[model samples]
Target: MATYDAALVLLVDSSEAVLLQHRDDQGLVSPNQWSLPGGHVELGETPEQAAHRELFRETGLTTSELRALWSGPWPYEAASRIR
Candidate 1:
């Protein structure tokens, strides 16, 4: 079994609208889909680091503040590689 760690950011506006990504149709993974902003945790990086990195890389937004929500083992299958 292979274990992969990841991080996600649930960006919400003042009106409580959550920001999501409309994945590009040309992508190899979940193409043309709506999802949260995040990606896998890279080497030597914590989940929080990965989360912030992914958020900026995908949405070009930056936040100087972030509260820890949750962190634990997730029951995700790596073979399917669902983002």
Candidate 2:
């Protein structure tokens, strides 16, 4: 079977911005980010579903609408801002 996964979009607005979660260069996998809500896939749940869940779970908000977009890498740096 194909590998499954999940992600989010964090329907942010004026107050909030596309949140970027990354660790410092404290280790090997300690530096990365992206501009959108995201997460991992779960059982009995689509990637979009997982993303929505993650959006609320991580940021604490709801999206009036959610859509499955593209696939790529997280585009963020150490000194970046969303809002």
The candidate that wins on TM-score is 1
Runs off by more than 4 Å, candidate 2: 1-4, 10-35, 71-83
TM-score of each: 0.77, 0.51
Candidate 1 residues lying further than 4 Å off, grouped into runs, are: 72-83
Compose the digit string of candidate 1's lDDT tens values, residues 1-83.
54567688988889999999999998654679998887777779888888899899999999877665876544455624544
What range of 10 consecutive residues in model 1 has the weakest lDDT sum? 74-83
User: lDDT scores for all predictions?
Assistant: 0.77, 0.56
The ten-residue window of minimal lDDT in model 2 covers 74-83
* Per-residue lDDT of candidate 2, residues 1-83 (tens digit): 12334365746568876566554454222335433545555668777777778778766877768777754334434212321
